[model samples]
Target: MEHDTSLITTIAAGFGLALILGFIAERLKIPALVGYLLAGIAMGPSTPGFVADVDIASQLSEIGVMLLMFGVGLHFSLDDLLAVKRIALPGAVVQMGLATGLGMLIASWWGWDFGTGLVFGLSLSCASTVVLLKALESRGILETMNGRIAVGWLVVEDLATVLILVLLPSFAGILGGTVAPTEETVPLWRTIGQTLLEVSAFIALMLIGGRRILPWLLWQVASIGSRELFTLSVIAAAISVAYSAAALFNVSFALGAFFAGMVMRESEFSHRAAQESLPLRDAFSVLFFVSVGMLFDPQILMEKPMHVLSVVAIIIVGKSIAAMGLVLTFRYPLNTALVVAASLAQIGEFSFILAGLGMSLGLLSSEGMDLVLAGALISIALNPFVFAAVNPIINWVLQRSELARRLEHREDPFAELPLTTERKYLEGQVVLVGYGRVGRRIARELDKRKIPYVVAEQNRELVEDLRKKGVAAVSGNAADPAVLIQAHIAGAAMLVIATPETLNVRQIAEIARTLNSDIEIVLRTHSEDESQFLQKEKIGTVFFGEEELAKGMTNHILQRFAP
Candidate 1:
């Protein structure tokens, strides 16, 4: 009369232990995922306690990946992704290559064959999207420029990994893995072609068809006025689209769910959907870490501690250095370089998947998989500490090293405006800080009215494009008085702080006031507390985002009825 309840038991045990350990971890000043992963390791088969169903746990983890990625999609705009392409695209590609090379070199030293080493190298190359999203959100930087760059870099790496996933199976035979059946032996070139075609088709379908259909579906469901149904619709869209993409087009579940969220972002109710999906994402993300811990064999640590150490070095130190160099080469600020470096000092879900796949295809040995898993566990657990150390590390280096200061203040061609700038732009023009969405709109209006403006933006590529268009722009943070002076702020009639709230508005205001006491200052902020602080300081005319939005909507309603 009784049936096995393995699924129920797994959930109960996973959650119960996760909460206790998670609490303990937080109290110890560590990320709670460290606790969740510890909970999994305890319940794993290797530890000889109560081992949960690996199969069920894995499925639950997959759901976590879907939800977490979908949540990111809700906040992440396509424009954000495109905006960082200049740095993210090349930075990811080069960093991955360097990481992969380091991995392969170490593997070869351990007597691994080329096929095994290649798989081993690849497994070390990519960082976890799940870990990154959670880290950024917790730190309240998910919408910041650094966060955008990190997310965009990971997205590009994920795309490249997907391609490798496709082509890896096809090249298994050639790479010294199991050969394909004689009847199904398609040429490598055709496999490459088909894989690209399929990936492209999937992207096109999501961008064109998914974008149009998803928002309409949300509207239809919202009109019904049922909260539960709206939540159900969002969850269904995330899981279903992710499942379908993997089933029909060979895209990764994370990518598919990400697209689903991006499309859902088009709906007016996106904030609601993100809130509704929050609990599930948080709970299942804990389960995801637990499952990852389950895959790790504790013996691997004892047996091949040095190999594990080597792999960790490549992931945490080697890859991070490579990424930092690449970013600095692109002329980003020193702090941006440090943050991104710290961001990538770890590996996660994709590494496990890649190692597992390689094992199945006979391209990797048990030792290889064990090594990758060990590196992942250690690096992921240590990633939070790495992030926490960024500011301290920067300060430590700057205090000790003259070269570091020089690099931080290095000259970029676009850092100064051209000598050909008209006098109108130099004197009594708008000194706009940040050339992002709001600033662009203001610049467009100024252009129409023939009011000259000099833009100060941190992104050098944006400045380059602006200059190419014959617009006056300087490439550096306006927080520096030198950057402001480069923009000729002394002669400017107004200082418009249209940047993200990451800047120290007070410092900028003081700098502008000192440079030109008559200049009017304007500012924008995302936080109510900060807005009040700024207003109290009388730093400028503060525009709190949500307050302004509410006022605009309220005024529109009033106007609609008055006429």
Candidate 2:
């Protein structure tokens, strides 16, 4: 009981440490994951006093993976998935094979047995999906061709990793002679057949049962309108499925998580699940990376520094080469190919699992673990630099030849930047707040006259919907100073605040006055009292939506009377 309490306490403490260190890492322009890893190192067995419960950390890491994969599946639209099919499928398999071959050769040179070498190579083949996704998001390239290819390639890598996770333990048991692949009653082929049958049944249940049942269950809960219950149910489904896959079918939990996500992808509840699971997923992911970092012993630098560096080189440099080859083969532009390659050049979560399993199975000692751990750390640390260099490299390549010119043209089909940046505000134009009924008619008139104007909207969904209709609108909180800055309030010739909410309109008018004391502010309110308050703030124009509708009706009556 004492030991259990201590374990719980350590895990709780480690969680706090991870969060604090993550902020520091962000401030320093380093990956928050690296900070989390460093925090884990500081709290691991090698460090002085603060040790985290390794078992608990491992379990949480599993949950992190499930949620992370689920989110990935949710975001992966049909278009994005179809875009990278050519490269991601064949390229992932070929690249992993090449990496494994290289790793096996290196291991043999370093005097490791074939079994150990195979595990080592398999570990080297994975790329960190979480890290790459975050990097792409930060660069605003998550929807780019390169980003699509990187994600799809990781998806392929993830499937291969799941296979490795299943095979490794079984192989270890067989090679160690603890369990024979073939027993008297069950021949090796028969055992394999049974295993396949089990896997098939499990998959059928998840795909068929999961697809039909999971969505219905979630929808039922959603109908109750209990946010807490909805969030809990999503978590329970993800965790339960992951556990069931591992416990019953002897497959990796990661595979179960992937399937769970794929099945849920068919549901309307996917977006809600993603939003709810993000916080938990991020917490566990930090812990997972930190634990990986803790495994790196700096002492190895003294003895086999060259070997460790070589592994890192292969991971960073070799992976890049393979990725570039695959990207180019798929007919992507040279710029996109380089970005895709550079983005996926780091060792990932599966590497930690592989190394840990190998250590437990007596395939690798502490020294070998240190080398793999060091390689993971060094590769991860350099990943940001590699990503940052991609744009510069692409620019340089673009200036080289005829091929470069074509690639550059492909990179930016619309070479012209938006007119929003030309001046502080969209001058001598009517700024529409909402693109609804009244605002739409006003915009049509403005368009007919060739007037320059900008639309600011607080509703992201609505903004995206309008964008599809070719309306120029920005999305954010109207009350935010940054939003006002982006919309360029200073030089605006006129402002149109049209919304159902009068309070919001008044607040927006106040913000407009704060930004530009000289610019005309318009308040589209439902109440006369609201208009008076807006007018008091030096707003030159005020249009009550209710009054405007009433006047239009009155004018129609007057015209009928004259006739």
RMSD in Å for all candidates: 2.6, 11.1
Q: Once superposed on the true structure, which residue ranges of model 1 sit more than 4 Å away at CA? A: 72-76, 134-144, 178-184, 250-255, 557-563
lDDT measured at residue 92 in model 1 versus the true structure, 0 to 100: 96
Q: Name the candidate that leads on lDDT.
A: 1
CA lDDT of 400 in candidate 1?
A: 95
Clash count per candidate: 0, 1
At residue 324, candidate 1 shows an lDDT of 93
Q: Residue 371 deviation, candidate 1, in Å?
A: 2.3
lDDT agreement with native, every candidate: 0.86, 0.72
Minimum summed lDDT over a 10-residue window in model 2 is located at: 408-417
The alpha-carbon lDDT assigned to residue 534 of candidate 2 equals 68
Query: What is the model-wide C-alpha lDDT for candidate 1?
Result: 0.86
Q: How accurate is candidate 2 locally (lDDT)?
A: 0.72
Each prediction's TM-score versus the true structure: 0.92, 0.69
* Candidate 1 per-residue lDDT over residues 244-284, each given as its tens digit: 99899877787788789988999898999999889888888
